[model samples]
Target: MRNRTKSVLESIVIAAILLVLAQTFLEDFAVLIGWSWNIRKILLFTGFFFDLFFTGEFLARLYTSVYNGRSARYFFAERGWVDLLASIPLLLLSSGPAVLALLTGGAAVFALGGMLNVLKVVKAVRIARILRLLRVLKLFKQIKYTNSIMAQRHVAKITAMTVSLFVMLLFGGSLVVSMLGLPSVDQVIADRHSQTVERIVSEMPAESREARNWLAEMTDSSDLLLVKRDGTTLFSRFDNRYYTELFGPSDYQYIPREGYDFFFDMRTLGAIQSKDNLIFFVIIVVFVLFLLIYYSPHFALTVTDPIQVMRKGIEDDSYNLEVRIPGRYEDDDVYRLADAYNRVFLPMKDRSRGTTEARSSLLDFDDVKGLLDGE
Candidate 1:
């Protein structure tokens, strides 16, 4: 009953972990698909809370293991290292520097010229979330200790392979994406501003006053600074005094412009990233599916089927009979197991049979002596 309760609790933990893992991946995917701000915020907070919870869990397990003098077994055999890595507060860690930079007016981060590059590298730490997949190992362990038909070596191996394949593809694909280098925030902003300027230029009126009126009707008044080709300001919506303070003379200017240059506001860049990252999105879906589908049947045939057959043979009292392994699998571990069992079982069965026959033949001597005495 105690074991059953423990199993039930552990099962609940695994289920919760699956949900958290899903949320973690979804948070990353949301960025590439331009999910809503509210949804992203919810995922972010959920991740933070779960990270804290897992950290506490790791600490509790660590203390318990140490108290029991089984620290090494817990850390190595029980995968404590995986728990430690997966329990890291990824959302908080990634957000820490950005928050500090903002609080310090960017000096805390940008004081050094290469600090921006360092921050970009820090963003990749989110990929460590993949380590959480290793928690599936505990599920296999749980199955082994419980009364489940699926509690077998093959099931454990398959679970390991599935988790390993997923982690490898996700981490490797994410690394590739990072190596290719996604567009920077500044670059995205500049490209959008240029496009908007070109479109507005083609439609603006020749007269400055009419152009100003049209611009006011079409765009945000505070964001545009329309100017003629000859260096004359045409329709300046910027506050002239603060404009000089905020922007340098050549800031946001377009090259070889005929009509005007417009100023655009900085906004969140998720939509642009989503559009540019379609290839990675497709790779994530297609590559994982292809590998899983390709390997499923192979696992069924080579691993699970052999284990099932061996188990059935033992249960049916067929240990003395040779396990009929396939010719091709003669070199495999399963074949060796069957061969070993047959070699030992046949000899033991023959010895037992001989002993039984000798006992039956000799047992009549005592009875014969007693009958002679009675006569």
Candidate 2:
């Protein structure tokens, strides 16, 4: 029963990790597809469901660890903080801003601290559960599990592959960004606009009669009239030819006939023009995340499934070595693994048979000894 419980717990942890990765990649994909606004809503719903299951299991294990008095130090110090941050979405909804702010600040600080001790924290959590599962495998220590060696090697290979993929993504993003020249484009446009505006303002002499009269009219007009760089006007008292050309027929409809206040707002304009570039960046990030997820299952199968099979085979003597894992591999690692296990076990099986036959032969000689005594 203890072994069964441990097995279930380990399975739950693996499932949680997979779900987290899936949701993360999916959210990134949605953003890349230019559905940025909707991605948040989708992720919120997905996370709520995932958190429900993960939170329950985490709490249960936490309680068990506390009750057992096993390394409560790490649990309370590191895992406890992660549990708190993981619950932030739910907690913030129920608490006041002040309380939420305090918790949020505390969580940020704790997270920074947690990063420093991440390896230790992960080891504590994974190792503890693994140790529990190993207890159930104590019986299998006597049996020669065929694919155990292959499974261990595959786990190392998968780890290296994942790390390499992550590094590639980092460099790829940097190269793409450099080629696009978004930063340079933005800076050049902004600098030119600034210089044009400065030159226009400096040319209008404050002492000139025409300039003084123009200033007076602007101040006297009920409707606001302000000249902006590139002939753009905001709430202008006069609908000048330049304004007419820039705004077109629809401009008069949106801008009141009466002059309006022109607040210098550049951010709105920038946002309108930068939408395409933002979408491009989002797409790149999403594509990379999707590729990672698409290959993740095969990666997990190569590593996880083999170890699981070896573990189960050790526990149950009836485990079939011929039960081939589903899915085809170009490299045939799984096939090679199965072949290796069979080779190792064939000799052990023959030795066991030979010993049984020799014992039977000795039993037959027992009657010979009895006949000699009778003679």
Candidate 3:
């Protein structure tokens, strides 16, 4: 189980990384190719795949809980609820303010559900399956060879830490993007401003002075300026205040063109670039810390636990086959070692007991012999 969990976690991390990379590169390609809809479809499919995997994982967890005599119904119901809610985007594409309102409301609910799922994953840490690959990889170590029981315990600890670290990094990244980068806020503002300018331009009469004046008003408020087909600045009254504040100077010289053209601050196009690099660094540091925490407990539980159990069992002489190391003893190698020790010790204990009985008998016989001699 520990191995299985580890494999799944690793796969998830890899998939997430791939998804991020794809989004970064493909978006630009789509834009250049004028296939933006195709890009959206690809993103939708990726999301669907993620949803499917999450559902499967949730169900597997639920099954484990059921087998372990815990109530699985609650988890199943909650996961099902999330799936139902997430399915909304699959069907609905209503336009206008209503769609926006629905999406906003759904986003809040989805966030809550996602948080709950995260908590569930954390709670399930105790039962996470150990990764088989990690166990096999550890076999290369010559000096500090762990028994099967200890290996299994370590595997579980590693799996838990991996999942925890991933969750932490994911949330941390989101927090940074939200608070500092403000990508969503920026997007919203940009959308609203663009729509407002488009509307104003559409309402303006062709080649009219009033149209030019309205465009000039918008240019004052925003960095965007309207240009005519004859390479004339429609909004000659435009003050590029925002552009100057953002970028040192306007690099593009606007010649009066034949058709209307829009100009704005180009530097603000990819503002999240720096934030992304910072987030990457932070995630790497957090992951390293997680690894340290994961392996530190192995010294106590992996080495000490089995030895203590063996000592206790040997001293008792009762030979409790049920006596087990306190930590997770699921690793095959550790289990075999424990079995070997038990095999060696149990017979030794029996022989010692028999020898003690024989000695007592000999002492009794000697005492009888002495009595006979005295007679």
Clashes found in each candidate (C-alpha, N, C closer than 3 A): 0, 2, 21
lDDT over C-alpha atoms for residue 360 of model 2: 29
**Which candidate's lDDT is highest?**
1
Better model by lDDT: candidate 1 vs candidate 2: 1
Candidate 1 per-residue lDDT, tens place, 244-340, comes to 4443221233334664445443323433333333344344335434434454445545556556665754554324455666778778887777677
Provide the lowest-lDDT 10-residue window in model 1: 246-255
Better of 1 and 3 by lDDT: 1
lDDT of 2: 0.41
lDDT of 1: 0.57
lDDT of 3 by residue, 1-375 (tens): 999978787676456534533443443333333343434445434544543454454466557667877644533422332222222322221111122323474353335437553222221211111111111111221113344545544543454445435544554554465446455544554565566556655676675677777676656665454456345556543355633432221112222222556554322332343244334434543543454445534554555566667776665655455436444565646555667666786667677887774232324566688799998
CA RMSD, predictions in order: 12.2, 16.2, 16.8
Write down the lDDT of every candidate, Cα atoms only: 0.57, 0.41, 0.44
Q: Report the lDDT of model 2 for residue 153.
A: 39
Candidate 3 or 2, higher lDDT? 3
lDDT of 2 by residue, 98-127 (tens): 132234743542364366432222212211
Ranked by TM-score, the better of candidates 1 and 3 is 1
Off by over 4 Å in 1: 1-5, 28-35, 89-91, 94-322, 331-351, 354-375
TM-score of each: 0.51, 0.34, 0.33
Candidate 3: 10-residue stretch with minimal lDDT: 126-135
